[model samples]
Target: MFDKVLVANRGEIAVRVIRACKDLGIGTVAVYSEADKHGGHVRFADEAYNVGPARAADSYLDHEAIIETAKQAGADAIHPGYGFLAENAEFAGKVESTDGVVWVGPSSDAMEQLGEKTKARAVMSDADVPIVPGTDPIEEPDAVRTFAEEHGYPIAIKAEGGGGGRGMKIVREESEIEEQLESAKREGEAYFDNDSVYLERYIENPRHIEVQVIADEHGNVRHLGERDCSLQRRHQKVIEEGPSSALSEGLREEILEAARRGVDAAGYYNAGTVEFLVEEDPDRAPGERLDDDTDFYFLEVNTRIQVEHTVTEEITGIDIVKWQLRVAAGDEIGFAQSDVAFDGHAMEFRINAENAAEDFAPATGGTLETYDPPGGIGVRMDDALRQGDDLVTDYDSMVAKLIVHGSDREECLARSRRALAEYDIEGIPTIIPFHRLMLTDGPFVDGTHHTKYLDEDLDTERIEEAQAKWGTDGEAAASGGDGTTTQELTIEVDGKRFDVKLENPGLPTNGAGQQAAGGGGAGGGTTSASGGSGGDQAATLEGQQVTAEMQGTILEVNVEEGDEVASGDVICVLEAMKMENDVVAPSGGTVTHVAVSSGDSVDMGDTLLALE
Candidate 1:
């Protein structure tokens, strides 16, 4: 019941919080960076403030600036959307200390307890929640080795502060332990600022299932079913479905009850998720399955609203954000555990502006020229991006989430297919085609996929087959030529080659459409008497390096001195986009030296190490 709340994040989740606040008649304040001045979230806020420069370090993540914004806006509380400061215990503590500014998340003590994986596991185990067998925080490298020996090789060294699969390494044998340990420590320190890591018995072929728990100041906690986030790539969840198809009624009850107990034990409040790694083994003989009984082990506890909360809302009809505000206002748990019901089935696919063929690398581009999200009964698209908005490289690549609700898993799959097919976006590469393939896959259709599904169950052959269906050169080139003339050039939309022919051989009289093909002359060699037929426009093309489309730093360069590269051998990694897009050999021939380095800024199409 806050009169106003400050949303301390950006992108879709920030917009989501703002909408929820509006519905409750609560005023909302948005903080934005210079880059996000025209962002969807900024426009949606009741009032907005310019926090800092476009860089996240100077804007969204600046704690003092955020606090000051909240104070200036007279916000009664702050909602830290997932990511950035959402799980920052110090930020939560700061908000709590500031009079009249309540922190609408788990208490700092609970975050600290759950932030450390070892502590969380211990706490869950004490509450009778099943957990993977692993040593609680080893103090030395030798201790890590000792745990590895007992747990049978192939253990995972995980950072106590790790969340997004970062700060983790899998050691398959004794020899690789030391190297993996150091790597894990380094990543932990870099990402979480905590070099401390612990070992866990790596569960091969496990399901990522998590139960959402909401508690109130009255000490009442309730379990809101669970979400099966098994479909993933590179340890990041790509698809999530509610009420895991793998769990039986008896097992589901046990896991839900266990999660409730853990929340209660941790003295938790507001919304949180207790994630577990469920062992997916169907080959074991009856009564010989240790995994069947204690399969779901505590992985970590998310101390705030999850990105996939929409999936839960789609099926349950619960407003988790409303609950957060209400809880902050001293409201008791609105509904008892029994009041919660699993209506149908819900699934969420994260639609990131990333190229799936290139390992789900992030992509950057300007506002979509065409932004059409699929919407119908049982389908919902949550996004804060729009056409013409600059898709900067300074933030997370996920632009939206495609969610579907159906009466059953099959219906959900069907809906997912329809939703993905209906979704259309232009300007940047997306994982839509990849998700479309996932929905049609057999293992996924049969509900047999696990956390390792993307790695183990993915049909690379089928993806290649699908890619072939669209014709090679990946999805980017698949769109091909639409047979439209933007300037004086005619782009080949359907052709396999990037043959841009000039239909009208003349200088571009207007600033509209794609780049003009051929030289800016009325006829080849017939330079118009007007100096250069196209005036200064042609002069601007000289000595331009094609920058990356997104915001990741560069990682590699495939082209070298006079080396011939086909149209698609990766030229260099445009790290800005958090993806490695090949500055493909735009044309076949020898490389004339790469213009960019291993680390350089690449915009949409600045000549990246050009082709001769």
Candidate 2:
């Protein structure tokens, strides 16, 4: 076993890895950014170090800083939790090469071979695994058109190193080919540092199924089971359930075996997931199951622990994270394939800090005035949030995950309803209401909803109603303040965060403090990463300004000064919360001024361009 393990990530996953290390009697080290100086993971770990600023590029994604922190902490191993450098082959190789530190995941060679989508598809094809017809790394738009000629319309332009919909775009018509292709490549480069992209024949209706597999250094591999993540919005999974109710016994076995074969063929080890797209039969009855003949194609591989690994844990009595550590330490499998058995059905709902009624807009700023999670038999909550903690809007929107287990799917749904109802949150907009609404949704309850169901089929009015009924008014709590005469200062010593308190015995409290208590304070306003308010830019900009709708980095400015644009024309692309949003022109006009460029950090309402 390792003496000390450094977690090179933040949020719940970092806390999760720390807990696993503690359970195995290993020391844990946590790395945090300035924005996360007060993060829950930092408090939970035995020791913590500051990496960089709030912007992920300078902090969480800085491979060198994290590696140096691990060295300073005397951590013998580095565990890159999902996201950031988790799947980066270069970072993994660096950790592997470090004198006394080991990387607690698959070998860098295996990650490089499978992390790239085009290469993974080639490997899967050689292993006789079914894959969707697609083209290799394509540069020109003509390649997309040519592929579309044979594959037909609705082509999926995917980044070579992208997953979780970060660098993916769907083109449904000829006119959208160039725009979607550029956006896909731009996202690919911005997110993965790779502009390489490929094409796939988009499946109109499919169930997103993935088999979780883990292997040890002793060459023993095991498939935990399958998870259905069809409940998605814009290709990002919102909910996931294990032992899919839509797959028959034979079909399930086939998919699971295929996943194992793909992993074994790639010479992979440690934790990984083999994703597949199972075609859904629209004409089939509501309760009908997919048989052996149903078409299923390999999607891609997630080379690290998944967010919904909790679902598999609830159904199977296996501690996947523990196995990850054991395998990395050169341990052999303790059980055979047949010995692995699933106990019951389980589902995981992502508790994201977004408003589903407003197109799932990520919250800009708010404090967790009240935070309460449900608990009981068959219910588990994985989170790192605390009451009064201000919501960190710098990274992803996911606040936590809710996992529910039951003897059967019916009972699981019933229990989920109770758990969601019992879950309470305040001062931050979340998708709790949407999850509650899904319990009564017919298609979802029948387990027939495909990956595109939420994006294309669900009614918007019902979501609005759900939000109106159950949603919290974040503005009130975000603007509210508590009276205090003492002011605290945050200081850093050798890249370690520390808090200092300064007290004034006779200081007047009736000025700023009293006004803050009456709803006027720094908490009432949101500042961009560049330390500027969006409203300030809007006030000075002239003409018809196209302002950002959320806080993110400007990935691309489509129109420059003097460029003519029409209504609904994309003026720029904004990357936010791991998703890309197009900022379009409100009306036909000529571009007068461009306020932002690629790689500029922006907040909600910051002007991107002005039209005359």
Best candidate, lDDT-wise? 2
Candidate with top TM-score is 2
Report the C-alpha displacement of residue 6, candidate 2, in angstroms. 0.7
lDDT of 1 by residue, 1-612 (tens): 799999998889999999999999999999999978888998899999999997676788899999988999899899998998999898888888998899989888889889889899888888888888877665566887788667787788988999767778888877887878876776666567788888888989887889998999898998888998888876788888997887777778778888889999999999999888877875633323233365577889999999999888987889999999899889887677778878899999998876676556565444576688999999987899887666765777788999999998778888888888788786666778788887777677767776777876675777645532322222343333333232123456667546343433233322233344553522345222111222243234332223444444455576676777676576764544322244454446666445556545433434455345
List runs of model 2 lying over 4 Å from the truth: 476-547, 561-570, 584-595, 605-612
Model 1 misplacement above 4 A: 282-294, 464-475, 478-612
How does each model score on lDDT?
0.75, 0.87
Writing each residue's lDDT as its tens digit, candidate 2 over 1-612 gives 999999999999999999999999999999999999999999999999999998888999898999999999999999998988899999999999999999999999999999999999999999999999998899988998899888799999999999988788999999999989888888988888899999999998799999999998877889999999999998889999998999999999999999999999999999999999999999767779988899999999999999989989889889999999999998898999998899889999999999888789888878887798999999988889888988988888889999999999999999999999999887788899999999999999999899989989999999988886667446322221233244447999999999665543333343323333344343434333223344766567667667777788889888879999998887887888777777778889898888899989876677777777
- Return the lDDT, model 1, position 421: 77
Model 2, residue 520: distance off in Å is 16
In angstroms, give how far residue 136 of model 1 lies from its true place.
3.5
Evaluated at residue 561, the lDDT of candidate 1 is 67
| Residue 285 displacement (Å), model 1 | 14
